[model samples]
Target: MQGRLPNGTLIAVKKLSSKSCQGNKEFINEIGIITCLQHPNLVKLYGCCVDKNQLLLVYEYMENNCLADALFGRSSLKLDWQTRRKICLGIAKGLAFLHEDSAVKIIHRDIKGTNVL
Candidate 1:
């Protein structure tokens, strides 16, 4: 869902089932890793909240959704080769930053079109 914090920053919140332990861990890990990272291409993670059993990830709203949505959805045809290349480069740079720039090496473990956003 779309929401705004007290500071007036726009955010997109994704709700996940608490029953999936793996999913919850990935969600928490992604939030933790992304919140400490900043990049022009990667989606900016603002903050997150854990309310009892619910997990809320607050991210800067992207005008466009995930890379998978742009690559395979109805709007897929709209992204030209150049745009696709840019996306690929951006994802690579983000990954490089995670591995080389950060103090601690992080293995994304899961990297896919959807996660590229």
Candidate 2:
């Protein structure tokens, strides 16, 4: 879900999939973790929604969306080797920050090309 703030800042809203069965604790923890991290390669967490039946996380929008969409979507856009390598490097840097440089070590439970942007 893409949206813009009143100040015109673009953002992507992620709703915790009901299938994940994530409770409020997980949601709050995620927010806390995200807020504590500071890295260029990682998406910025803007805020979150915890209203009634809603559990949404707002993040900085990636103009290119995700890697899966670019690779599998019905688009003719072709990425060169350099672009792909840069994406991989960015992912590596982000993971390294989470797993090594951050104050709290974070082991990402799931990682997929679709999760990259």
Candidate achieving the largest lDDT: 2
- Tens digits of lDDT, candidate 2, 1-117: 899999999999988765557787778887887877879998888888887667888998887767887778644557789998998999999999899999999988788867887
Candidate-wise lDDT, in order: 0.77, 0.83
- TM per candidate comes to 0.79, 0.87
lDDT of 1 by residue, 29-99 (tens): 76786788876766787877777788877788876667787778845447889988887888889889878
- Stretches of candidate 1 off by over 4 Å are 22-33
| Model 2, TM vs. native | 0.87
- Model 1 lDDT, full chain set: 0.77
Task: List candidate 2 stretches off by more than 4 Å.
Answer: 19-21
Q: Cα miss at 45, model 1 (Å)?
A: 1.7
